[model samples]
Target: MTSQDLLLRILNKLFLGLAAAGIFFGVMGRSRAAERPNIVLILADDLGYGDVSCYGATKVQTPNIDKVAESGLRFLDAHSSSATCTPSRYALLTGEYPWRKKGTGILPGDANLIIKPGSTTLPEMLRKGGYKTGAVGKWHLGLGDGEIDWNTEIKPGPLEIGFDYSFIMPATADRVPCVFVENHRVVDLDAKDPIQVSFKEKVGSDPTGQEHPELLKMRPSHGHDMTIVNGISRIGYMSGGKSARWVDEELAQTLTKQAVGFIEKNKDGPFFLYFATHDIHVPRVPNARFAGKSGMGPRGDVILQFDWTVGEIVKTLRQLKLEDNTILIVTSDNGPVVDDGYQDQAREKLNGHRPAGPLRGGKYSAFEGGTRVPFILSWPGHVKSGVSDALICQIDFLASFAQLTGCRLNQADGPDSLNILPAFVGDSKMGRDYVVEHAFVLALRKGNQKFIEPGKGPKFSKPTATETGIDPDGLFYDLTDDIGETNNLSIQVSEKAKQYQAELEKLRKEGRSRP
Candidate 1:
């Protein structure tokens, strides 16, 4: 009963303690592995590269969005896959190039949905991985099938493409049928006032923008004038859905409230929110409260609205105390352009504000500013605050989030999305080897060198503006040497151009997202 008995007893106790520890940690390990971060993707519509304070917009202040950048990683070199609205949104949601889907350019509000139903999408992937998904604000990805009947429920819209809930604009704010479509139905549509839409001939008497310039509050400098809505000429024709029409000034508040409500409701469960904003876009009708705040007209006023909306979201996160468990990705659909279609004097009253920061080209061009825009990420305890030059794309979110949740996207779907969790964590310095840049045709970006193809330049129409690289030559420039993309290096570096050309072809052949 002396030393031998005491030693045996001590050894037995130690073995039992070790067994319990193993079981406890094993369960904890599985739980951590199953732990998924709440994902928030805030997409600013038609916002220029330099529109936000983080991106260097001196004309306006966006302190709230800047706070997200300060709290996390600010990506300086982020490029949207396409230069236009529809294509870029499509590419971002599906992880595929816009050109892959024919007839899928900048869609008219009247046109039937472009995205095929029952396909794999970003929000859909998250839903499959045990996440509640919703998209609040603009949905330019098209809706319904061929010959959609307005009186009936709309099909194959955002909800059909993987969103569990959606409240979005059918197309652009400047377009007709200017109503909010929630889930499968257009909101507030009275049965008596059936909606009818057409991109071509007018269906009823609504005073065409061309005929009734007297009623116009916002006149178009280009092709925007068509139908009159809320005293503004739009791009298409719509006769009904009168009650469903959205108030342009109140759009920011509506979207912000919806986003905040969703976050508060889902605090207990991991959720994914695709917050798409209609600020700084064409038909820049900021609320009366935010009017003249930027001293730049409706364009600048809308920027203020956007900033305040962002502040509300950040405040909601702090209030919920879910900052550490959430991963917020803030990026725009494409670069900025002042005129777009409206004559807001964005070009004249521009003052010293640089909407594209140091990049060149804007919105619908193959140049740097056209595709490259501001990108920032925030995850309180998980991500440290700093600026990163790591080249990333909107397409990569599919693979990144999928990797985080132990979900895998079939190569047929997310072909171009590379899982950059390490890069997101700020440990790795590499992203994609080469990313294809699209304005209309195609361009190639590899490392610091960018190669643009010649002919049929992106701006086929005047609405694209002159800033859109229409020079009758292939554009090439080293970003390190020319951040504004002023100098063309097509002749100076012929070999580098050829290499990028090959890269572009390879990626194109492999193809992009489907749906």
Candidate 2:
């Protein structure tokens, strides 16, 4: 047969396979199962800029994530839209800044579903383009509509947002009702003993960190004190659901195994997996083998576990021979915090470890560290590997992927997304014109000049211990000379401040910031 005939035969085989798979597994939530590229967005919870070795972390090695970087693009000036978890995840999935939603600073444990049903999402977009999408692990973004019923199927969640399958912890591991929700129902929930949860009153006589400080391996510094699970105190109250609770130490491997199985089953066609790993997040429970591996305590051990998970995913990709076709984007939700809360010796044994690397501020700071994170795009024979300070943000992913897959996200859909396929593939140097960041206030950037809007109320209520948002009172700084914001150009360069303030307003008014 001629080369053209062979090409046609290959295409016909792939088309037939995808159609059959979609018909067989439509109930699993995969609406489309062809044409789209397999997208695996691996997000690390509360992971710092310096956590991965590729980002200059010296304490522990991340050979797997580093491999992705070595093969593709590693972004040095990339950032999460919000400093905190829930809002950041919201922005990531929705392609819109989190501040727009009312009371969207940082959601509490029992809050209703943040992304309402029928919301347009990255996975939803991919599904339309013919892809099997799944989300496994750490879904801090809330679930259910109005009142959630843990015993029954939760609505307006990952399924409503376009994932074919979902196996997730409802909130942070350090939060209440510690149980895994698979797809719609709570995994292994008992009918005989119902589970009850609340941020208000105690559900039962369950041991709490407040009542039993001696039970804690990692003591809480603030906020994270309520129900006790696996000898660790968390945020909300819970009673019963003993069979459904997950083992803390085994969190990483459990998610990894599930992810691998999903990939193996869907290897024949394009798939989208929003794989959120519960590593180094909270409770800091690293399995026996990885415990104390970094000599920095469980926090460090969890870092190792994160690295192993990355390696396993990469190995699985190689095994399936999908490295070249698959587009792998690895990044963290926010910067690092040595002692956000919890005593994992993160500070005591942090030694010279730089969790935020060279950036100042972390997690909840408007500073460089808060917004900037380690961003990588890997596709083995498709992208050239190199560092770029092109000022990319999580909000940009929606439009970027849409452009890559030959799809369009109408203005209403990806209001914050920008097409930068050339940048992702290392063919273009020109990138985003301006980027808006944070949950509290707006910070606009044009080239090296960055200006932050003063106070528009604020997220944390009280002034955070850290510079959680862009300094209010209209601060303008020339990051080119002073990247740390040490010398306030706000007073000195009032004109530049005015310039970016205008840009900030235009961003909000237009709903999408202009490049």
Please report the candidate that would top lDDT against the real structure. Answer: 1
Tell me, by TM-score, which candidate is best.
Answer: 1
Q: Could you give me the TM-score of model 2 versus the true structure?
A: 0.90
User: On residues 7-75, what C-alpha lDDT tens digit does candidate 1 reach at each position?
Assistant: 999987875565344432233232333668898888888787788877777778898898898999998
Off by over 4 Å in 1: 1-33, 457-464, 470-472, 512-515
Off by more than 4 A, model 2 = 1-35, 456-464, 469-472
Total backbone collisions, model 2: 5
Cα RMSDs, all models: 5.4, 6.6
454-475: candidate 2 lDDT, tens digit per residue: 8755434332255555454776
- Model 1: weakest 10-residue lDDT segment is 24-33
**True-structure lDDT of candidate 2:** 0.78
Clashing pairs in 2: 364-468, 433-515, 434-515, 454-472, 454-473
